[model samples]
Every structure is written in structure tokens, then in C-alpha cells.
Target chain A: MKCPLCGLEFNQEDGLKGCSGCKSMGACGLIKCPNCGYEVPAESGIVKFIKRWRKKTDESK
Target chain B: MTVNLSRKRPQCHSTADMEIDARRSVVLVGSPNVGKSVVFGNLTGMYVTVSNYPGTTVEITRGRLADDSRAVAITDTPGMYSLLSITEEERVARRVLMENRPDMVVHVADTKNIERMLHLTVQLLEAGMPLVLDLNLMDEAERLGMRVDTKVLKERLGIPVVATVATKGMGMDELKKMILKEDILPSGPPLRYPETIENAIADIAKNLDSSYGISKRAVALLLLQDDHEIWQMVRDREPERYALVDAIVKHARERFADPLNYIITIERQRFINTLIEDAMDNDQVKGIPFRERLSRLSMHPVAGVPIFLGIIYLLYEFVGVFGAQTAVDFLEETVFGQYINPVANRIVSSIIPWKVLQDLFVNEYGIITLGIRYAIAIILPIVTTFFIAFSIIEDTGYLPRLAMLIDRVFKKIGLNGRAVIPVVLGFGCDTMATMVTRTLETRRERVIATLLLALAIPCSAQMGVILALLSGSTKALGIFVMVMGTVFLFVGFLAARLMPGERPLFYMEVPPLRWPKLSNVLTKTYTRVEWYFKEVLPLFILASILIWAGRITGLFDLVIKVLSYPTGWIGLPPEASKAFLYGFFRRDFGAAGLYDLKTSGALSGVPLVVSIITIALFMPCIAQFSMTIKERGWKMAVGMAAFIFPFAFVVGYLVNLILNGLGVVL
Candidate 1:
């Protein structure tokens, strides 16, 4: 995911670590961009599945 | 994926054979988010999960290149800015390069940010590693009308430069070829420094006969910069010459007013400027794109306020009207109230028989009835909608511009524009925002920010309910904004005056604005909802148990009776005291309670507006209170809570008195 603030593309896990390190309550479920400290929400499994489905459909077309 | 380095090493090999057949490692290093991972993926064709680097929690990714010619170990180090490490991650990146002693060092850099990233490139060169300069993200650079003359840059730096759009598999074959070759690029000369510093380097280098994985020149520079780790390494290696090295560094420091790191950086920047003059071209024209124009308009002081207000208005519409009134009501009334609660109550009453156990499960403040219901019915939809709106704001890259727009005002409150990050975040969760205050530079700034967040900022859950409560009365909403806005500014101004410290400097990288992707927005909302539920469900259950305990012990009533005095003082009815008491647990819980009161016609006009202002300005929820204590220490957190609790009622009372005295009615 691209960090909105710094525009650095990082894996979602790196963002989650950044969020956890900040001692957030985990309620926001945001991944902090390790590069610029901007918070981004992680993609859900359902959302990920939908995205993959959409891409597969697009490819089929 | 695998954070353990020990687990990652190939096992069951003889030491001799291991030394002979060990793949030549190609280590990738760069500042964070430069697509180093993408490049690594392209080269390796394998999955490498991020894990803590050994004992330290810093994440590092290691993979192996799939090549017919030979096995190549490809390790992607954590992002780092410079070799003179300040952060733990930077130290880890340097450690990977130093300890691995890789055959090739691929310095990946974002093409658009070459000027800033070149400083790291110079540091890498100084380390005397065989370097390949991978100028990644060429697509983004061209889109911004930036063109880098790769031939000129390579010629100037004396390294093989490869331009790539890593995401699209551009330039990977050449990158792989360069990595596989033994003698791809010559070891370049170390970055030139001022004559005085160069003399010091030479003096220090003369005594260093031992090989450090990196060049002696780099070690000498590290020594000059007072890098503690390098100094220790030198002390352990060359105890006899360590004193001499220290004396040289001390002498060099004495000669310059500024630190050696700053001096070195300035020199590197000067060299980069010279390199850029011949290599980089910018065809920036007056015909800016619509997105760029919108970006500028967002940061314009005059126009930005309306834009900011418009965003807030939209937030109120979505989370307040749509989520709170529409979704929350349906979930609360039809779903939970009609079906879930009644069925659960019957089961608990029939099976359990004991009133205490039954109440714990299905009564008014029962864990299952109230806690789960509030988490699912009241807060979830509201928070989800808020996250969707917030994701749009974030993905569009409007946040940094908002920071720039409010920087001038933030400075007056002893904070720079950077404080906008935590402040904007406070809207989502004050607990998280309190923790984020550590990102601020000074203790004074963190304390001031903490105080403001506790006293004024309402979390999304609370904001949703407050917006819903006030949506019916324009005058009430207007007065609520006026009252809370006044307290926010007034306290901030006083806090700034009271705190003594150097003013923080403001600097932020503003990303270009673009349309938010729907997939991203939906995913963000879903993740945030999941996270919100995971965090709040337990807290809500615990709060219910605690409230149950308090009710049984008679403490709850006593507290409410004590709270009712202040509630009445703020012009709210005695029934509103329950909500204020609940506010101590979670700000949203109290606001939701107030929503119940307002809908039942228990509050109206000036009293309703006063209740909204008071709850909005109330002390932060219990979680934020504890977080403040953890981040800022007991005295500060307790002091802030002490101030905020009474201050909320005082401000609410003042607003009520003023409105009632003026005969203003909503």
C-alpha cells in the first residue's frame, strides 16, 4: 500500500508493525506507514477476495 | 514472513562446503517505500515475509533469486535514511549490509525523489560496496514531467544505473543481469568532503589496518560522526589506535561549529546539486492538471477552511444521518431490541434462574445485552462510515495539504503543522491519538497535544452520536461547534503560553492528490470495522461487568448522585447524569446515552446544546486516560484528567448560562 502522506509503498505488515509499535488501541485497525507515520487501514479478507475476483473477471474479459 | 535470521540460514551443511557453495548474496537497501520489495520480488520470484531481525523487533525480508546460472541470496533490508543510524531500523539496515558482506549492493531509489535520496547513495558508495543504482518508479517521475538522464547520472556517479517501473516488470531483466555479473560496476570514489574533513579522514584511515566489511573511509566517516556502534567496533578491534582516532574526531569537531553529520550532509547535497545540474530535467509547465490545482486549493488558507468544513459536514451526513440515525436505529431497534435481546433474555431467565446471573447476561446493563449490543448496533456502523470517509480523505492525499493549511494556526498553539496528524487522528480514537503524540519532537508539544485531545477532541463513535443529537437542531449544532471550538482554541492558546520550549520546526512531504480507489476505500472500511470490533467488544463487556458491580455495591448510584450536581449545573436534567457517568468509561457510550435522552424528549433547546458541548469536551474515555498515563506519566495524566473533568462542566455551564441569559432557543 502507498502511504498517503509520504507516498512510500510498503507491505501491509510493515504498516501493522508501525501501528502496533505506536501502542494504538488496535480499534482503528490502521497500519501506520513505517516511512512517514501515516495510518492506513488494512484490507479485510473479504475485500481482498472481492478484489481478486474483480481482477480475475477483468482478465477473463 | 520469517523474522528469524537463524531459521532462515540453510541448515545441515559442512562449514567448508558452506563457505565454498554459499550463494553470492545481493542485498537491497534504500529509504522506506522505494519499491525495494517489489524489485526483490521481481528478482527472486519467491515470497519473503517480514519478520523481526533476530532479537530486535525490526522487520527484514530475505528471499533467494531463481536463476539458471547460480543461486543468489537476495535480502531486502529495512528502509534507512543514512549510514549514521538514528533509528533502530536504520541501524538494522546498516547491520544487514555490514554483517552480510554481500557481493553486490543494489541501492534502490525513487526517481522523483533523487535529490533527497542521493545522500544515501553517497553513503552507500562511501562504504565501498559494488553498487548498482536502481532508479525505480520512472513512471511516476515522467508523469510529474521529471526526466532523469540516466547516462549522465551513471557517468557522473561511475555506477551502472537502471531505470525501472518495478510494479509493471520494467527493467528487471537488466537489473537481474547486472546482479548476476561479478564485475558489473567499479567501486566509486567516496563522496568528497571539505579539505579539513578529508584531512581528518586520511589521518584516521592511516591507522586502520583491519578490514571492517566496509571500506576504511566509511569507518573513518562514521568515527567522525560519533557513531557509537562504530566507535565500539574500533575500540574492540584497535584499542591501541582507538585513542588516536578519538582525538582526531574531537579535533575535527572543535574546528566546526556545526556537527560533523550536518557538515557532511551539506557537502553531499552540494555534490548532488552539481550532479543534478547535468543529469536531471524538469519540464514543469504552467498548465497544471486538475488534481494539482485541487491540491493547491486545499492548502490555500482562505479556500481551505471551507473545504475543511465541507469535509466535516460530509462526515456528519454520513456517520450522523446515515450511520447513526438510519443504520444504528435499525440495528438497535429491529435487530437487537426486537429479536436478539428478547430471545437472549428468555434463554437466560429460563436456564439460569438466579437473578444475578440472569442480569449479567440479559438485563439493562448486562454484558451480552448492553456491551455486545452497543459494540455491534451503535458504534460499529458509525465507526465504519467514519472510516470510509477518512479513507477517502487519506487516499486522496489531502491530509498533508490540510497540515500545511493549518500549520500557521497550529504554530500559535506551540505545535507545528505536524501536530495535525495526531489531531486529525484524535477524531477516530483519542486513545490511539494519545499514543501517537510520541511522534512529536518535544515533551512540551506532546503534553499540550495530549491535554487538547483529552479535553476537546471527540472520537468517531462519540462524534457520530453528537452529530446525530444535534442534526435535528441547526442552532444546537451551531452552538455546540461554537462552544467546543472556543474551548479548543482557548485552552490551546493558554497551554502554548504556559509551556516553555523551543518552537518545533514544520516540514512534511506533500504527496500529489489523486482519486481514491473504491477497492481501497472498501477494504479500509472493512479492516477498520474489524479492528474496532476486536478492540471495543472486550472493553464494552468489561465496562458492563464493572458497571454491574458498581450498581450492586451502591457505588454507581452514589457516583451518579454526585455527578447530577454538575449535570444540573450545566443545565442538563438529573437523568442526564447517567450519561455523564458513562462518559467516564467511553465517550461514545455517554453520547449514545444522551442520544436516548434527546429522542425521548428528556432534553431540548439550550439544555440539549449544553449537554452536547459538555460531553464533547468531557475527559477522554478510560482507555485514553490510561494511555495518557502510560505515555506522559502519572502526574501529567492525572493532572490533565483533573483539569478536564471539571473544566468540561464549567464550559458547559458557561455556554448554558450565556445562551439562557440571552433567551436563545433552538
Candidate 2:
């Protein structure tokens, strides 16, 4: 899947991911452009989930 | 691609005990207003308004950036986008990066929209600034069904990329580790351009012999686009090198179909795309996930309406009924009313001989007898339960789901999904929600939200008491709903009509539902209750002091006398006048007074209903008045009070008339 906006291609899991804020496609990119808080969509869930779970696991340890 | 950007040389100079060494200080440097303040506050211990919309954070807020680092100072800068500064704010951030250069910089970007944001990230990498990319608002990204393979992207960029939900404090640890490690080194096959572009870049890099902070190759690319900041920096320090860079940019600009910036952005996208393709594999089903399907059903006009009502009912049942009726009665009457106040009165009478002094401590309106008791006994328990419930809702991230569920309906009345927070919060505290109106995207939305909050949404105390009161009466509850619902919709529509503006679009990143964490919920509850106690306890005690003074001065009698006509008109007893006055001090106090009247059998059905209705529509507490003044200014606060005073009585009169006229004898 290609992020139509950014054109970052990934697989199915990457296409259907959510952010930590609200779990929708509204605010998942990184931060609102430090310049503008405009909402930007990211890739899907696989990479995002792995990264987050890894982060959480790291914290727990 | 984790890069070690930290190099230490600065002498220990900061005198503040809070000073964090560069090794410990993982500065979250990004463009302002990118939730950096929130990340800082959450990681460290601070309280910054999540949304004040004041973009220029002139002074940096320092927090002991918590996590794996024993104690680090996290710095939040005004919103800035790139290393190449165009705006003064950007220059400030760049200066921070150059001067205090912390162990690492966490680049927080709105995850939903990364294409535009990543440009700055790329620039930072090019500048070789120590960095970890935080794909913040992962909740928002997931809601929109966009996926980001940060690990893959991390591998490709060769920098530590951590995704975060800074608002809810998710992924902070991973972000911290990534920052502490400063592990990703920004190295890759520098993004290759088309052969023609490659030759052009080669020509430029060959001529430009400048050992800048970043690679000269990256400098050449920035120069090609005529990045003014970079160009200015080069011109000042290396005019000879800049002259060559200028020629390459002019030539490249001539070759590009679009503007040079656009052309560069396209190339950057190409690079990001290529990297994603190699490292990422998203395995999502087509059409919709079961969650999305459930969400669709939940938002359906038919199904959603019922669900919304059901949720509202549950909220009232737990918060209003259980909290207001059971917990409040037990605490206010059985505990405080029966035992504490009497014991305190006897003790104060025995200890203090001066009547005036005794009045201050244990009289009818004494601080101990009334103020502290009310704050601790009546408000605390209710607020604790409420904050716990609220934190859970917020943590589970159901609010956005509820927003989407009701967005369509809200749109019809000139509101959007964002209005959900204010309206829902109004149930907990209208004053707080009024302050939150700043979050609405538009001035019109703020006005409408504020109006709805004041006119309809009862603050927690009033709402809970009212809910408790009416929960027993099917007809009364139905009537209450009809009246409040009608007024909310009607006023919102009217405000939207009067306010001149384009209807701002509704967009919310509705995160997937999750079970709320208990500790997080408890912490949030504790914070809220502590704040509530601070605000309420003082005001309640001050109110008691005022009441005592009023009694001694005969001011209380005069006010009660003045209130008598309205009381008579509304068909209530003379003592009810005191309740109305207390209502102004705090709605819950008036509610407690009403309970005092009800339990004593002073007023029954019609008068009770009328009195309840009127007080519910009446002015909020002294604290609320002060808050209203602080937030909306004197004009709105005074005007709101002016309308509410007689308006409550007049409405009470009308309701009495209607019920009396209809022979509504319950």
C-alpha cells in the first residue's frame, strides 16, 4: 500500500494502522508540522504497532 | 538509522537545581505546537495547557524529562518546522540545537499527515542534528487507517524512529530509549535523483567546497531549492562556496517543471516511498476491519442515535444517580450532616468565647461546619468517581468514537466532532469545558460550544443532583430531557446562525477502543480531585466566611427578603430563599440546601420540580463566576449572570404556571 499523500509503500498491515492519540486516521503521522497542526495520515499498523510494542516493552524492562 | 548527535563541551553554569546534564537532557526540539509541550509535561512533571493556541512559547518550559534517563531536562520550543530557519521561531530552535545541543532531539510530527512534516525531519537529518523521529498522534493515524512502518523507515533512514501517543503517554519509553541511545546514524545511499539531476548535483557539490555542519551533498540539495536560511548561513560564513551553490539552484530551478521546493519535495517522497517499499509489508484486509464495521454501525443514523442515548443514560445512572444520590446523601447527611457538623459546632462553642470568632468556626455558615465539610464530604467523593470515569473514557479513547458516532447529528446543528469533548466534559464541569472552547477550530465553534455549555450542560454537581432527583420520576426525567435537549439544539442552531463564519470541517482521529489502564486512570483521577479540592475547598470556605459576615451585618436577611418575592412567585417557602442564594455560591451547595428542604418535607412535587428546574438553569458557583470572568472576560460573565438571575425565577414561575395550569398533581 502506498500512502496516497506521502507515497510511502507498505503492506496491508501498514495501510490500516492507527495512532496513539485516538486510533483513527486523524493524527498519526508524527507531530503536527511544528509549523502547522494540520492532520497527516501515516502508513498502516504493522510498523507502527511493532514500534509501539517494542517501546512499551523497553519501558517495562 | 540512529545517529549519535550528542557531543559535550559546555561548562556547568546553570544555577537552578533542576539543571540537567546534556547527557541526561534529551531535548524534544521541534517546530512549536507539535505536542512537544504535552510530551514534555507528561515525561517531566509540569502542567501546560494542551491547547492555548498561543504559538510563540517565548520562554522554554523545562521538565525533568523522565523515563530511562535518571533525570533529564526536556525542553519544548515554539513550533518550528525545519533546521533551515525562515521564521524567527525556527531560528530560536536552531539556536537551541546549536548551542545547548541536548543528548538528542525528539522530532514530534503529526502522524496522520507526514508528507509535509517529514521535509523538516529530512532537513534535520541533513543538518546532522541528533534526532529521534516521534510519529506522534499514532492514535489519530490509526483512526484514519493509515499505517506507518517506523521500524522499516527507521532501518532505511538509519535513525531511531519511535511512534508515540503523547496525549495519553503511550510510547514515551521507546521514544526515551531511542533518544538516550541516540543510536540511529543518518547514513544511507544519499537519495539518488534522476541521472540529469545527479549530474547537476555532482556539478554543484564539486564546485561547493564547504565543510558545513551537515554533509556538503545535503547542503547542495538545499542550495538547489534556494533554502533561504541555508543560503544565508552559507553567504555569511562561506560566501565563496555560496556563490557556486547559487548558480546550481538557478540552473536546477530552470530545469524543474514546478517550483524548486515542490520538485525537491517530490524527490524526497520518492526516496521515502522506495525505502518503505523495501522494508515494510502491511497485511491488512480490504473493505473494513471488524472494528471499522462496528464503528460504521455505531455511527449509523438509526443505530447510533440509540447508542448515544444509551451512553448518556449510563453516564447519568453512574455519575448522577450513584454518585449524586447515594454517595452524596451518605456523606452529606449521614456522615457530615449527622455527626461532623454537630461535633464541630459543640467543640467550637466550647473553645471560642467571642461570638464573632465562634461564628467564623462553627456557626450556621462556619468554615468548618459548612466549607470544609462540603468540600471534603460532598464534592470530593463525587469528583473522584467522576474523574476516574472520565479518565477511563479518555484513556480507552472512546470519546472520538462517540464523536464520530454523533458527528453527523452534530453537523445538522452547526457543530462537528470536536464539539464532543466540550459537550461531554460539560457533564463533568461546564466551567472547565468553557475554558476548553479554545480547542474548537473556529471562533464560531468556540462561541457555540460556550453557549451550549452555559445554557444546557449542567456542571457535574448540578447535573448529578438533577439526574439523581429526576431519575426516580419517569415523567419528570422525560420532561427534563425534553426541555434541556430542545434548548441545547435550539441555542446551538441560533448561535451558529448569528456567528458569521464558514462552517469549519469536522475531522477527528478516532483511535481504536481499548480498555482503560487502572493506574493511569487513578493518577488522572488524583490530579483532578486534588485540583478540584484546591479550587472548591477555598471557595466553599470563603463562601462560608462571606455568609458569616453577611449574617452579622444583616446582609443575609436583606438578600433573603429580596429573594422572598421570587420565592413566593415560584411557590416555595421563605427558607428556600437561602437555598437560592447558596446556589449562586455553588450549585451543589444549593442542591444540598434543596436536599435539606426535601428531607425536611418543606416542599413536595410541584415546588420541588420547579425549584430544581430553576436552579439547574441558574448561575453557577463563585468559582465558576471567577473562571467565567477569567476565561470569557467580564462582559460575557456579567452578561451571563445578568440573564440568569431573573431568568431562573421567571422560568420557575412559568413552569409552576404550566404544571399548575395542567393539573399536574404527582
List, in the given order, the native-contact fraction of each candidate.
Answer: 0.55, 0.00
Native-referenced DockQ of model 1 = 0.37
DockQ of 2: 0.03
When summed lDDT is taken over every stretch of 10 residues in candidate 1 chain B, the lowest stretch is B13-22
Task: Indicate which candidate wins on TM-score.
Answer: 1
What is the alpha-carbon lDDT of model 1 when measured against the actual structure?
0.79
- TM-score, every prediction: 0.74, 0.57
Local accuracy of candidate 1 as per-residue lDDT tens digits, B367-483 = 888888878887787777878888898878887787787676677666545567787668767887888888775677788889989988888778877887776566676677767
Considering summed lDDT, which 10 consecutive residues are worst modelled in model 2 chain B? B1-10
Error in Å for residue B487 of model 1:
3.1
Q: For residues B370-475, what per-residue lDDT tens digits would candidate 2 score against the true structure?
A: 7787677666666666666666766665555665655676778765556666676666667556655665655566667766676667876666556655545557
lDDT of 2: 0.64
DockQ of each: 0.37, 0.03
